[model samples]
Target: MLDYDREAARYDATRGGDARAEAAAEAVEELLPRQARVVVDVACGTGIVTARLRRPGRRVAGIDRSAGMARMAAARLPGGVVCGDAAARLPLLDGSADAVTMIWLLHLLDQADSAAVLAQAARALRPGGRLLTTVDKNHAAYHTGGDVAALLGPVRDAHTPPQSDALDRVLGVGSGLGLTMSGRTTFAGLGQGRSPRSWREVIPKSPWGRRMDAATLAELGSRLGDLPDQDHPRPDPVYTLIALVKQD
Candidate 1:
């Protein structure tokens, strides 16, 4: 595991303000009841999403394994933020949170650990409280074409992108731990559909999109240039926001 502590400062810069974070936040907000108050942002890197959750009367907390990440999150959030691992025991009490949000973090865990994390999230949520998570689409089996090797630079190892269905299955495992699916939202167009024109026109338009420097942006354009047109069917990275509610 990359110690996100050392990389916390630059992680958001590298990923840009991930759109998945916004989508996940929206999902959580919508799923939460009007009275729900306390919310936990799990695997909160640099507190970007946590900052967005700050509002009057709504208590927000952030938890992450990286001390650096927690520090960043705490600086942005007025609520309590703790440095802790998501896979193991969370530093919160059972049924302490009214809602939980996990963004762009599940796929990082292997199958077993992922389930453990989900279970722990469920444990922390009060009965009927919601849990929102964004999971990557199944790309390893569906992705074809595009200069993946060139874009990533130096293929270190053969890794499979977690299947969307596999993520659902993991959630199912957490069902035994008392979480039921309430709703879902999907956000697509991550790391795909970058044309030279769109890259130039769109990449600089948003904070998350603006992190790419001129060189990296040009390199991405060049590598993707050889591929079929953006219209071509490809494995688009989809972020699925699953809303799970704790069953009483």
Candidate 2:
């Protein structure tokens, strides 16, 4: 994964920024219960979404592993942000949170780490509390079907773990922990859709790209370069979020 600390400064800009943040927060809010007074956002990079999650009666806190990310989050949330690892343990007390959110977090990890984060989120939720997370993240980015996806699809599928943030995978992980899927929602990734040229630059440096042989990488680059609208963004991808309710 890219160094989150180093990426902190440009994270929002490279991401969809405020527009995307608003869309995400709005979708999350739709599934979040009004009575969920205390919400903990795991891997809350820069707290952009966390800040938007706040309301008159809701208390929102953000936790991130990167010091640089936590620092930026702290600025937006004051004393409500902390530096912590979700794959290990969240700093929050067990059964204290009314809701827990893990937005855009799980796909970055292997299955074991992903399971650990889910278990931690389960451990932190009160009975009947909700855990919301993004699933099928790897697939979301490539939904703009065309030459770009055709060229990169096979490589991505081979590199991506079958259980990495898939809905079934997340449901299975949560099953043993008394968490079950209750609802789901989708939101547009506003500024995140990529162009042929962008994919050429991204695929080579991406985590999966490191596993790709030199010849394969060069071939993909050449094909992507040959595609039309090299600079035009494809249709934006829609991200899926699943809500799991802890058993009472």
Candidate 3:
């Protein structure tokens, strides 16, 4: 996981920025029930997308674990953001929120913590309300079917941990907690593609990459270096979102 406090300053620019935020918010809104008025965005880093989720007659607030990230969120939504750990508890009353969103949160946590966060989200949601979240976040980058994926797919999969936000895992967990899948959508991660050189730089710092042997890392770096258009980014990744509605 990243030191979100340190990354907060550059989070939006480095991420897909406004373009990506717009697409994500549009998709989320589509899945959200029109009657949903009280929405809570869990782990709503920087509130970039959270702010965009707002609409007339609807109230949206954000919750984040990092003070730095929450500060930025609070600026976008003054008096509407809280700094707290969603995996443990949400500050909202039980069955208080009409909707809860976890945009890019679960992939950062281990399975146990991810389950805890899902449970907490369920606790805060009203019956018939929905929980919207992204799934398979870390692996979305490879689904573009670019040369970078072809070269590193096998190795990457072998080194990667069990993803907490994988579609099946999420579905199963949500079902167990009385949150059944109600909708699904995808959005392009605009301007968030990686080049061969960029992959070489970031791979070594990734969670899976940290477990790779030095010689293997060096060889993978060499392979990435040999690819053409080292600085030209490949196709953008399309991220998946699923809406789970709480049963009465």
Candidate topping TM-score: 3
Q: Please give the lDDT score at residue 152 for candidate 3.
A: 80
In model 1, state the lDDT of residue 156.
Answer: 16
TM-score of model 1 vs. true structure: 0.71
| lDDT, candidate 3, 1-248, per-residue tens | 78999999999998999999999999999999999999999999999999998899999999999999999999999999999999988998999999999999999898999999999999999999999999999788877797988888888889987899999999999999999999999999999999999999999998778999999999999999999999999999999999999999
How many residue pairs clash per model? Answer: 1, 0, 0
Query: Where does candidate 1 stray beyond 4 Å?
Result: 18-23, 137-165, 188-225, 228-237
Q: Write the per-residue lDDT of candidate 1 for residues 1-248, one digit (tens) a residue.
A: 67888898787756535664465466566656677788888988888877777667888888988898888888877558888888888877999998888877776777777887888888898988888887544332123334543343232112223442355575767678877788877665444433434433554453333555667656656655655554443444455667888899
Candidate 1 lDDT at 159 equals 26
Tens digit of per-residue lDDT, candidate 2, span 1-248: 77999999999998899999999998899889889999999999999999999989889999999999999999999999989889999887899999999899998888899999999999999999999999998797776576677777787778755747888889988999999898899988898889989888889888788778899888878988999999998878889998999999
lDDT of 2 at 57: 84
lDDT of the candidates, in the order given: 0.68, 0.90, 0.94
Note each model's CA RMSD in angstroms: 8.1, 1.6, 1.2
Give lDDT: candidate 3, residue 39: 96
CA-RMSD of model 3: 1.2
Ten residues in sequence with the least summed lDDT for candidate 2: 155-164
lDDT of 1 at 218: 65
Q: What is the TM-score of each predicted model, taking all chains together? A: 0.71, 0.93, 0.96
